[model samples]
Target chain A: MNPNTAWLRKTVALVILIGVWEACADLGYFDPLYMPAPSKVAVALFQLFAQGTIWPHLIATFSAALGGLVVGLVVGTVLGAVAALTPLVGELLAPVMISLNAVPRVVLAPLFVIWFGIGVGSKVALAFILVAVLIFFTVFTGIRDVDRRLVERVITLGGGRGALLREVYGPSVIAWILGNLKVAVGFAFTGAVVGEFVAATKGLGYLLSFAQSSYNAALMLALVVLIMGFVLLLFGLTGLLERRLLRWRG
Target chain B: MLRVDSLALAYGATPVLEGASLEVPSGKFVSLVGPSGSGKSSLLRAVIGLQQPLAGVIETDIGAGDIGMLFQDDALLPWRTAEQNVALGLKLKGVAAGTAIASARQWITRLGLYGLSERFPRELSGGQRKRVALAQVLAREPQLILMDEPFASLDAIVRARVTQDLVRLVELRGISVLLVTHDLEEALALSDVVYLLSHGPRARISGRYEVNLPRPRDVIKARSHPDFAPLLQRLWNDLSREVGERAA
Candidate 1:
């Protein structure tokens, strides 16, 4: 199928589904308090932005997620590279990384809140842990899976360990990192929001807590939609970055 | 000159090559042909020090950096342009970026890849990629080159053209080659000397032939030489016997 047509079809399907939901709500088949109509959610979304009440929450969430993402990317890459290049380090680090990867690490959000307090620090800490483990695995496997023939070619050309790292493994690792970047971004946001959901003074998750306490279903849906929209926008941007960086792969 | 004497190679307890021996004199091209699973590639790997030998000796006057290799796969870095890929050896050897790139451009053109310097490996055809790989190996000016069925992936026409270019380039530069292939005709056409390896539980050199064919050789025309047919027939018969014994 043509990509544009596929996109158009998806849009039409969503619109039809929303139209059905609105019709059902108008017909009173559901409780308005529990299943707020799409129109009511839209009003709630518009009011949240227009009243300027959501700006601080938006900024808080964005900064924490982005800060954790940057630090995690850099630290994870350095540590993973150190492990991959040194056998002793790799053997020591492997089991720890494997176990970390196997667990649902978000449960540590409460501990992060206790250590960093119920603020941006806690959210950033959670985001960092979530992203770091993911990127560490990406870099470790990327270096290990480098084509053996390419390594041989570099060695035959008089490349030592340093050259092999710079020439053969470096670019390949970057490609792998970029390929996994979207997932990492998603994890970063997840960490931030979930940390806030557990404990926070100000964030989208704080607003979610308020909505839950007041049983305001319309406000809850509005916040959820706003977060989804922002994440999708970031996904599109990262995709552009991937295409630019990996033009050679085409 | 490169020489391997009584080389024995194995992967764990599975012996690949035993008592294998060969030679490639300076400025001469040599070929090693064998049935599949006869450890032809293992011998090449052992000579290059990529694989450790179980026992035996490889003696070479070539410096550690003075050897180049071409594989059946092009092995070009997919992320680098043709020119950059060619320049990789020079860059790794500590050539300044400007000089390395200029020299790479020259080799790219020399290999009939004009105007393709900016193309990545994925953007090039199989034949074009092979030419770039050849340039990559030759740009370093290695004293000896080892090839493992380097042209086996090309179509017959592309193979003929590439072999012609290879012969011309290697001969012009006086670089010795030790090529491993199962193609009897390619071995007969390209080599000054050919060694046939026996089928393995423990494979070793089973037969040898001297190609008296003249130099400045054309790959296609060399095959039509009156002597070409007989040498190919003898090599084929020997190889077929190895395959037949494996079946038995």
Candidate 2:
């Protein structure tokens, strides 16, 4: 399928969905209090932005998520590389890492809040753990699965250990990480918001809690749409980077 | 230019080749032909220093860095462009970026891949990938080249063309070559000398023949040479017996 046509089809489907949703609300098929029309949600979104009420929460959430993502990506990649290069270390840590990953990250958000307090520190820490485990597995497998023949080719060409890491393993790991960026972004956001839901003074998650207490469905839906917008933006940015970096894949 | 004496190779406790010896004189093409499990790949790995022999001495006048290898699977890095793959050896050697790029581009052009330098290995056809791999090896300017069935997966016409081009390019550079292949015709057509090995569990060089063909030989037409039929027949007779014995 042509890419343009695929995009067009998706846009049409979304438009039709919104049209049906608005029609249902206008025709009183659903109560606006529970299922607000798209236009009402848009108005709520506009009011929040115009009053500048959402900016602080948006910034707080963005900072915690992005900060955690960077920290996790770096730490996980380094640890994974060390594990891959040294088999003994990998063997020792494999089970421990797997067990940690198996634990529900949401359950740990409360512990992080108690430890790091109710600031962005706890949120960032929670997001870090979630993103770290994910990226660690990715980097570890990527490094291990690097083609031995490719490494041999480099070695025979006079490449040493450093060269092998740079030429053979580095690009492979980067490709794997970039391939999973969309998922990583979603996980990072989930970690941040979930941390806020457990305990937080400011964030989109805190606003969600506030909207729930007031029984404001429009505000809740608006915040949800805004969060989705940010996630999509980050996902799109990563996709652009993937295309630029992996142009040779063409 | 290269010599292996009394080489004994094993995979852990299991022996593969024993009492194997061979030589490739300067600027000559030598081939080792054997069945699937006869340890031809193990020998190549040993020579390239990726594997160590149980007991043997491999002597070469050139430095390890001056040897280029073409793997049986092409082994081109899937993430790198053809030009980048070709330029990798030079880059590893600390060549200036401009020099490496220039050299790689020249090889790409020479191998009829002028517009394909930016394409990754996965985007290329089998024949095109082989050509790119060949260009990579040639660009390394190695004094000796070790090829492990570099043309194995290519179609007949492409194989013949690639073989002919490889011979012409290597001969022009006066580079010694040691090729391992299962195809008797490929071995006979391309080499100055061919060694036949018995099948495992203790594969050895069962026979060796010197091809007295002239230089700049066409691999396609070499089969029709006057001496080609008899030489092939004799080697086939020896090889067939080994195959039969292994089957038994």
Candidate 3:
């Protein structure tokens, strides 16, 4: 398929779907209270942005998610390297990391809120746990899965432990971490949003809760669209980063 | 310069190599040829210290850090450029970055891979990648080189060219080599001494031949030497006998 035509087809399909939804709502196919018209959601989205009511919420969520992501990545990489390099540490940390990975870490959001008191700390904590566990596993497996032949080659080339880590394990871990960055970003946002949803002063999730209590379906859908758009934007950025960092793979 | 005395190797209860002994005198090129599963690669791994021997001793005057090894598969790091890959050993040894890269570039050019220093392994063709791997090994200037059929994957023409380059480099540097190969012709053309290993289960040295071929040999043209064909036939018969014994 031609790239331009493929994109045109996607836009046409999305436009048609929205038109159908609008037509159904206008024809009273569903209750307006539960399923608002697309136009109504769009208007709500416009009002929130034009009135600037979402600025504080957007800033709050963005900072919390970004902060958590950076911290989680650093901590996870350090811990993963330590585990992979030292046999005793690897054995000691394996069960703990495995158990943490087994659970849906998002469920801990409410407890984090209770401890950190509905501030950015709670959201950051939730996002940190979510991303750290994921990146930890990625780095750990990445190092372990390196080709044994490559390791032997490096050794026979007079490389020692430090050289092995720098030349072999280090690049392998970077690729794994970047490859998983998309999921980590999603998890970070999920953590921030879910924490706010459970309890928070100002965030997209807090607005969602408010929309829920008032039964404002149009506003709720608007916020959902906003959140999805932002996450998709972040996903695109991470993909570009992955391509740049792993250009050697070509 | 290198000697393996009654080396034994096994995987659990299954013996792969038994009582295998060989020697590579300084500045000599030695080859080990064997049938499939006859522990030729296992012996090379043991010599390089990648695999521990079940029993016996390996003695060498060269230190561990002075050894270089080439594999059948190109083991260049995917993330590093050809030049950087060649410079890795120098960098590890604390050679300054500029000097290391300059030396790497020189070796890369010497291997007929000029102007491809910036290409990654994935971007290079199989033959070019093999050349880069050779440069990576040779740039280190190792005193002892171990090869495990390093040219088996290349086309015949490319293999002959690489063999010529390798012979020139090894001779110019006076490096000792211990090669593992299944090709009797390749062994005859490149090695001063060729050892035939018996079929596995308990593989051991079955025969040894000394080739008094002149130095500065051309790998492809050397096969046309009067003595080459007869030596290859003798090695081939010994190898077939080992295979026949295994089947019987």
Clashing pairs in 1: none
**Best by the DockQ measure:** 3
Give the per-residue lDDT digits (tens) of candidate 3, residues B1-248. Answer: 99999999987789999999999999999999999998999898888888899998899999887788889998999999999998987787678999999999999998999989999999998899989988877887788899999999999889888889999999889999999997899999999999999999788998999988899888888899999999999998888888887898
What is the Å distance of residue A190 in model 1 from its true position?
A: 0.9
Residue ranges of candidate 2 with Cα displaced over 4 Å: A1-3
Tens-digit lDDT track of model 3 for A1-250: 7886997899999999999999999999978999999999999999999999999999999988998899999989988888887889999997899999898998898899889898999999999999998888898888889888788878888788988888899998999999999999999999889989999999998999999999999999999999999999999999999999899995
- Candidate 1 chain A has its poorest 10 consecutive residues by lDDT at A149-158
**How well is each residue in A115-155 modelled by candidate 1, as lDDT tens digits?**
99998999999899999999999999999899998888787
- Candidate 2 C-alpha lDDT tens digits along A1-250: 7886998999999999999999999999989889999999999999999999889999999999998999989988888888888999999878878998998877898899889999999999988888888888999999999888888888888899998888889988999898887787898899899888788889999998888889899999999999999999988899999999977665
Pairwise TM-score winner, candidates 2 and 3? 3
Q: Model 1: what TM-score?
A: 0.96
| Best model number under lDDT | 1
Query: Model 3 - which docking category?
Result: medium
Please identify model 1 stretches exceeding 4 Å from their true place. B245-248
- State the local distance difference test value for candidate 3: 0.91
Model 3: how far is A231 from its true place, Å?
1.0
